[model samples]
Target: MTQPPATPLPPPRERRRLRESKSLSQAQVAERVGVTRETVRSWEAGRSTPKGRKRTAYATFLASVEAEHAPAGTVAPPSLNSRSAGRHGSAPLTRSVEFVQPPVRTAEPVNCPHPTRPPKTAAEAFDRLYTHTAPALVRQTYLLTGRRTLARESVERAFQLAWQRWPEVAVDRDPAGWVRAAAHEYAMSPWHRLRPSHRRPEAPPADAADRALLDVLLSLPPAYRRTLLLYDGIGLGLPETAAETEATTPAAANRLLHAREAVAEKLPVLAKPERLHERLAELAGAEKLQAPKSTLVRTDGERRTRFWTRSAIAFTVLIIGTTALTLRTAPTRYEPVPAPGAVISGVPPQMGPGPLSQADKKLRATLRGSGRGGPHRLAPEAG
Candidate 1:
């Protein structure tokens, strides 16, 4: 028999939203669907589609989930075929299936005042994002680091970075998330410990319970603390928390578990995750963690970019100048020079004529005595 037509799956993003709404992790979904977690990820990311039996299984799972979460009186359209019904023991699938669309609210004007128009310029877009997200992000950073100044600084810096890369940030799926990750990284940087200002701890919350919760949170490792904040404090799904924390799903789960246990051990009242989340929100809200103005952030980012750019140019020019000067002053040709003469030692001095030899002295005396003409006469008589 011919295989049943492929199941009509929801859009990739919708599939992920459905899973997360059901509080199901990729690993959990993968297990139930008899596939690897990577396979499920690929399917959700639209990198690949499930085929044959897996396709039907995945579609069935998503449809059932959607149906369960659908509003009252709404139903998910059936996409299963007769072959699928026979295998699952459901009613025989019909060829024609109609999808049910939710009722649209038309009472409100199409141009509502609340939803602002899209930003026309990059600066406007960046400012809009900063204004919308900075306040909460500052508070979140405060919870992450427990330093008010650092919290505001982190948010400001993260926005500056975002402004610097506006093209990337504007097109990002979650600009707030991009900035949040940057802020979290800056707040938790190991280098911050070296600063004299950060060397001392910030004051604890005034309320006893708030103080206690903050202490418990700060006592945990930074990784564990961040995981708890993202998962419990921010209500992010496990995959999202893991992705934010740069960890695997299992690793994020482990961190969350350990963090929760630590918090609960210290503060029994916050044993429940929900209670912990509430306490965290309360503590963060109580702080005076205000972010800088969006205009200031944008200006600072531009100023910082200019400063670095000019500094780089100046440094390059200095290097070029120094190299040119060296080349100009350097010797062009080789010149050889004789070494200075040194005194020779260790030779016997010449004896002053060593007293003229005795024979030479006698001949000199005889010549002097016979120098007269008598010597010449005596020589002639002998000839």
Candidate 2:
């Protein structure tokens, strides 16, 4: 004779109760099923009902658990709110259980150089580039300009320019290099040179000698100052420094060598490479330059709008002013008749029209004779 069929397992809630009653932790059950404890929790809480193999696995585990605790032929208790509980008129063995799925989580995409898709707009790309590079750029700029305000202004203005030309900037192989060069140019702008400094701010110094070294560094020509900063202050190689400053490797190396000599002449304490690097680091820290907030950087659309608006206004003003000037200074075809008294010729001035020809006089006589010298006539003769 065949054996009787196995009893069906109760719902998810009852299964959990049965497991807890048996003192089997969710971990043990999860390990048996090859899923996470959280997954097992989801199964038991009914937030996510298992399907196919997972369902089968869960039912089997629950059945085994129930069988192990309770004797054969005993019916497991109904789960909370299950139809079986109401049909059987059986009170819940325990208080009602509630199931809530943990909130579904989504990972935010990070902006990085190697993202699967490039940033949607040039502004996004530029901002990402700025976020990653601005601090180091400011530090380098501070080293070059020797003035905190000037360095900060240079970096900000360079970023603004970068935002304006983001399309070109976004695709650059070395976006930081481009920004560095731009900041350098801004730091050394003739406009900045023309303005005299009211007072020189003191550098952050290890001692008196560090301040003297910085002063000498600032006193060097812009080219030498920038080369030394990139090579030492920023720790770029000779070729990279050359590329940043738009100089050949040999020229950058030569400038760096001479810059070291100049610094040594001014401050004998920093003549050694190790000594110079330490002093540069001290200066970089003292400047305390920060990366500008991304929000402070305007988007590509805003920059484009401002540029086009200014261009249109300028073009309109130029056109209007040019028209006015052309009208004012333009040469005329004929000279004005001399003033009444100033007439050089003895003949009377021909103010209105020259005297009518003898033929014209005859024509007038004929028109009057024909009664055509009235306002209705088409010719002046009518008047």
Candidate 3:
């Protein structure tokens, strides 16, 4: 007997149609692609595209994937390097570039060769030292010399000289003492020079008492003031004071005596020695000390750079202008003047304006004469 027609299976949905066309299935493709069943469900439902290596390998495992349900692909697997190379082209730089960059360098201090180098720094140092020392060296120098200006000038000169020789003086037993001695020598030396012409000392302000004291100090000779300040103001011993001022011990003592006597003459009668030494100390204490500062030194490279940069800019501009002028294609010419119409005005208009015109001026003169009868009879002088 013929069996009843076998039950026809219902056609697969579009997803199944595509899967059949590509020979894939939800389970098989999912298994082949190593994705979850839910992911395959989403793909079949058109929710997402299959991604990554599994998509590339999808086709390879079609048969196994069909048995187990998986994705399909025909292309060979893509390597990581190949993928990267494909994303960004394998190209080289277009030009050979050279960049000029500056390098960092350690700073070097410049030496002020002359003993008379700017005392501004030493003066500052003296100011600092003056505050700390029992007897300020700066003040003592001024008091000793009876010339505050000279004293400041001398000490600063000495310090600059000594600083330059720091290597030699560095190992000295007493650097500060050496500097002090050098200052004294500088003060008394015939070589003592004036400051640069470019820089002049400002005049000291003179109040009454200060004026009187300054007059007294200035009145004494340099020698007497030097001895007094070095011996008494500075409280230096006889031999040390003598050594500083370039005088013998006895000579230093004599000058010291003279300094005191000179000062005493200007003061009220006070028998106590404290009165004199204290006054001397005060003078020594009041002097100024300036702080040190860096000074400029000449350098060949700096000079060359400065010179060439300025010259190069000027030369470049000049060359460009010359080239532009040479390259100009047109030339200018002056045109000749034209004669005027009719008999012609006396002056050509092109020659520029003149008293309206000679003819016009002459006509105006005739009209004025005719209006006045005779030019104007001189007006009678007012009584």
Specify the highest-lDDT model's number: 1
Local distance difference test, each candidate: 0.71, 0.63, 0.47
lDDT of 2 by residue, 262-305 (tens): 99887888877756766775566555466556556565336766
* Global Cα RMSD, each model: 19.2, 26.7, 41.8
Of candidate 2, the 10-residue stretch with the lowest lDDT total is 98-107
| Error in Å for residue 226 of model 3 | 0.7
Q: Give the per-residue lDDT digits (tens) of candidate 1, residues 46-95.
A: 77999998998999999898776444322211111111111112112111
Window of ten residues with lowest summed lDDT in model 3: 95-104
Cα-based lDDT at residue 287, candidate 2: 52
Pairing residues by index, what is the TM-score of model 3?
Answer: 0.37
* Pairs of colliding residues, candidate 2: none
Q: What does the lDDT come to for candidate 3?
A: 0.47
| Tens digits of per-residue lDDT for model 3, 108-225 | 2223333223334543333222222212345556654555666666566655555556566555655556767777777776554354631554354244544456567667887776
Query: Best candidate per TM-score, number?
Result: 1
Candidate 1 achieves a global lDDT of 0.71
Q: Work out how many backbone clashes candidate 2 has.
A: 0
Better of 2 and 3 by TM-score: 2
TM-score of 1: 0.61
Greater-lDDT candidate between 2 and 3: 2
Worst 10 residues of 1 by lDDT: 93-102
